[model samples]
Target: MKLHNISFNNLRRRKTKMAFLTIGLVVGIATIVTLVTLTNSMSSDIGRKMDEFGANILITPQQNGLSMNYGGISLGGVNFDQKEIRESDLALISTIRNSRNISAVAPKVVGAVEVDRHQVLLVGVQFDKELKLKQWWNVFGKAPERGDELLLGSEAARVLNVMSGDTIDIKGEKFKVSGILDQTGSQDDSLIFSQLPVAQRLLHKEGRLSFVEVAALCSGCPIGDMVLQIAEKLPAAKVSAIQQVVEGRLKTLDQFRRFSYAMAGVVVFIGSLIVFVTMMGSVNERTTEIGVFRAIGFRKSHIMRIILLEAAVVGVLAGVLGYAAGMGGAKLALPMMAEGKQVQLVWDGVVAAGSLGLSVVLALLGSLYPALHASKLDPTEALRAL
Candidate 1:
C-alpha cells in the first residue's frame, strides 16, 4: 500500500481523536475569519459615513499681512489687499492627481448684507453641493432651490424674527425664507445662506469665491499629497488639510484593524497548540504500530510522511468548514457590532484562500515535532509496548 493510503487508514481508525483535533482547528479558524471580516466591513462603512460628515480640505485666498511692533510694543499694521479666488479656478481642483478621491467641492462666497437694518453675514453656496457636504444639517423646512429662496440659521432667523415661509428683503430684493437651520453652535447658526449667483450679485463679487471646502477623505487617500497638489493647481489660494478630523477618523479605523489582527493571533496560537497536543497523543498511541512498520522495512521518511499526511488532511477539512462557519457568524454579529448599521458581508476569494493555506501550514508546523519523534523511535523499544 502507498504511504497516503496508510495515513488515510490510520485516520479512519482514529475517528474520535481526529474529530476532536478537527473541531479545535475549525473553531479557531472560524473565530479569526469572523473577527477580520467584521472589522473590515465596519471600518469601510464607518469611513464612508465619516467622509460625508464634512470637508477635510479647505481652500482660501492667500492674503499678505504685515505686523508692526515697536519697542516691544505691538501696534496694528496696514494690511494688503485680500486676493479673491476666481470661481472659474475651481475646475483646476479636478485636474489634480488625486482628484478621484474628491467627493464634494463647495465653493462659498461670503459678504455682509443688511436685512431689516440688521447686518447679517450672507454666505453664497451651491445648494446641491452644500447640502451633500453638510449631511448633518437639520433644517426646519426644505432646502432652497431658487435664487429668490433663502435658508436661515437659527440665530439669524431669531434675530430677524422670521420663520420658514416668511419673506425678507435683502439689498432691496425680496427672498422667501425656505428653511431655518437648527442651532449648530457654529458661525453658521448666525448666518444666512443664499444661492451662489444671487449672493455674488448682491455682494458685487461676481465670479469670485471667498473660499472652498473639499471633501476628499476616502479610503487610502493621501491627504497631505492632495493638499500640495491642490495648492500647486491654485497658486494664489492657500490649501490646507483639517488634520484633526482626518487623524481622528484614521485612528479609529486603525484601532479596528489592529484589534482584529491581535485577536486572530491569539486564536492562531491556541489552534496550533490544540493540533500539537492531539497529534502528540496520537503518535504515542501508535508507537507499537510504528515499530511494526519499521520492522517491515519502512523508512523513517515514510513514517514521517504518514504522520504529516494525516495532519494535512485534517487541516484541509478544518479550513473549508471553518470559513463557512466564520461567514455565517459574521453575518449574524454584524448588526450589533456596527451600532445598528446594516452592513453586507463580502465573500473575498483571497481571504478564503489565505485561510485555507494558513490552516494547512499551521497543522504541518504543529505536527512536525510529533512526526519527528515517531520517525526516531527504535523498532525494539516501540515493539516492547506491543
Candidate 2:
C-alpha cells in the first residue's frame, strides 16, 4: 500500500482525536472570519452614512480677492469680488462623471431682510434638499411646506419674537413662520430659512444663488477627482472638498480595523498552540507503530509525510467548517450591533480560498516539530517498548 494511504487509514481509525483537533482549528478560524466580516460591514456603513452626516464639498463662485496687507505694514483695507453663482447653472452639476456619488445638492440665496422690524439674514433654500442634507437638524415644528412659508432659526426667532405659525411681512408680502430650527450652534442658527424661489423673489436676486453645498460619498473614492470633475462641469464655480469630516471618519474606521486584526492574530496563535500540543501527543502514542513501519523498511521521510498528511486533511475540513460557522454568527450578530442599519455581508471567493490556504499553512507549521520527532524515532528504541 502507498504511504499516503496509510496516513488516510490512520486518520479514519482515530476519529476522536481528529475530531477534537478539527474543532479547535474550526473555532479559531471562525472567530477570525467573524471579526473580519463585521469590520468590513462597519466600514461600508460608515462610508454610506458619510453623506447623511453632512456636506463634504462646498461649491462657490471663483473670484479674485484683494489682500488687506500693504508692504507688511499696518494698512488694512480689504476688497473682494462678490461673484454670484447662477441658480440656473446649478443643473450642470449633475453632468459630472462622479455625479452618481452626490447625495444632496442644496443651493442657497442669502440676503438681509426685516422680520418684525428686526433686521435678520434670510437664507433661501430648497426645503426638500436642505432637509435631506441636514440629518442633524431637529425642527421644533414642521419644515416649510409652501413658498410663502419659512423656517426661523432659534436666535432669529428670539430676535423677532416669533414662533411657529406666526406671520411676518417680507418686502410687502406675508410669510408664515412654519417652524423654529433647534439650536445647531452653526451659521444656520442666526438665519431665517425661506423657500428658494420665494427668497429669490423676496431678495430681488432671481436667477442668482449665494452658494451650493454638496454631499458626496466618502468611501475614500478620491474626493479630489470629484472636485476636478465638478470644476470641469462648472468652470465658473470653485469646487472644494471639506476633508476634515471624511478624514476623521476614515481614521476612526481604520483604528477599529486594526483592533480587529490584532484580535484575529491572537485567536490564530491560540489555535496553532492547541494543534501543536495535540499533534505532539499523537506522535508519542504512535511510536510503536512507527517503529514497526521503520522495521519494514519505511524511511524517516515516509513517517514525516504520514503525520503531516493527516494535519493537512484536518486543516481543510476545519477551514470549510469554520468559514460557514463564522458567516452564520456574523449574520445573527449584525442587526443587534449595527444600530438599526441593515448590514450587507460581502462573501468573497478569494477570501474563502485564502482562509483555506491559511488553515493548511497553520496546521503544517504547528505539526512540524512533532512530525520531525516522529521521523527521528530510533527503530531499536521503539521496538524495545513493543
Candidate 3:
C-alpha cells in the first residue's frame, strides 16, 4: 500500500482516537482565535472614539491645586503654573517644524455666569475657527453671526426653556439666541458659545484665554510626540494630548486582553495534553500493524511520518474551522462589546498566519512521543502480541 493509503487506513481503524485528538485541537485553536480577534477589534474601536474628540492636542492653563483619593487613601498632586497662553504662544506653536498637521486653532475663555434665571457656563469661541473645531455640532437655527447673538448647547437650551429667536439676560445685558446645538455628551453640551472678544470683555479679562483647541491633520501624524515636543518649547503653557488623557483606560483594556491571551494559552496547553494521551493510546492499539509495516521493509522514518501526518491533518482542520467560528462570533459580538459604537473589524494577516503555524507545530510536538514509540517498535515482539 502507498504511504497515503496506510495513513488513511490507520486513521479509519482508530476513529475514536482521531475524534478525541481533533476535539482537543479544536478547543485550543478556538480559544486562540477568539481572543486574538477580540483584542484587535477592541483597540481599533477605542482609537476611533478618541478621534471623535477632534483635536489631538489641548493647551490648558495649569491648575493650581488638585488631589485625588480612593477609599480614604489620598494621592498627591503636582503644582502647575497658572499663566494663560497668549496669541503669541499660538503663533509660536504654529512655527514648529513638521507642524503641517496643525490645521485650525481656537482659543477658549470659560467662566461661570448667570443667563436669566439659570446659571450657565459661558465659553468664548472665534466664529470661523469654532465651527472648524466643532464640526459635529448640529445647529437647529441660524448660527451666531454677530457679537449680540449667542449659541446655546442643547442642554443649556433645555435648562433655560429657551429656543432660537429668544432673548436671554447675561450679566444684566440681554443677548439674542441665534442657535441651539445638538447634544454631544461632552462638556460643550452644557455651555454657551459667543464671540471671543465679547466673552473676554464680559468676563473682564481682555485678550486672555483659558485654553487652545488645536485640530491636527491626523493622517500620518505622530500626534502624541508632537504634543510633547510642543509642550517642552512652551514651558509657561500646559499641553495635553487627547490621546494621553485616554491612554490609561486603553492600557487597562490592553491588560485585560493580555490576561485573556494567557488564559487561551492555558487552554491550548490542556489541548496538547489531550493530544499526547490520544496519540499514545492509538500507538499502543496499532502495535501489530506497526510490526507488519516493519516486517515489510518500511523504514522507521516512514512510520514516524505517517503518525505525524495524522496529527498535521487534525491540526489543519481544527485551525480552519476555529478561525471561521471565531470570526463569526466577533462579528456578532462587536456591537455589544463597543456599546453601540460601530467599529471596523480588522483581521490581521500576521496573527492569522502565526496562529495557524503555531497550531501545526503544537500538533507535531504532541505526536512526538507516539512517533518515537512507533519508530522503535520491535517487529518480533509486535508480531507475537496478537
Top TM-score: which candidate number? 1
Candidate 3 local lDDT, 1-386, one digit each (tens): 78877788878887887877777787777677777787788877766555555776888876686777878888776576567777567777877765786767888888889876677889899878878766778898978999999999999999999999999988888899999998888887899999988998899878788898887634346777778777877777788767655666577777979898798889778888888888898899889989988998999999999999888887787777767776777777777776455688878887677667767887888899999999999999999986
In terms of lDDT, model 1 sits at: 0.91
Candidate 1 has a TM-score of 0.83
In model 1, which runs have C-alpha deviations exceeding 4 angstroms? 1-16, 23-27, 68-77, 255-270, 293-306, 320-349, 372-381
Looking at candidate 2, the ten consecutive residues that score lowest on lDDT are: 74-83
Please report how far candidate 1 places residue 362 from its true position, in Å: 1.0
Which candidate leads the pack in lDDT?
Answer: 1
Q: Rank the candidates by lDDT, best first.
A: 1, 2, 3
For model 1, name the residue pairs that clash: none
The alpha-carbon lDDT assigned to residue 208 of candidate 2 equals 94
Instruction: Give all candidates' CA lDDT scores.
Output: 0.91, 0.86, 0.81
CA error at residue 251 for candidate 1, angstroms = 3.4
Error of 2 at 366 (Å): 3.9
> How should the candidates be ordered by TM-score, best one leading?
1, 2, 3
Each prediction's total of clashing residue pairs, residues at least 3 apart in sequence or on different chains, is 0, 0, 0
**1 versus 3: better lDDT goes to:** 1
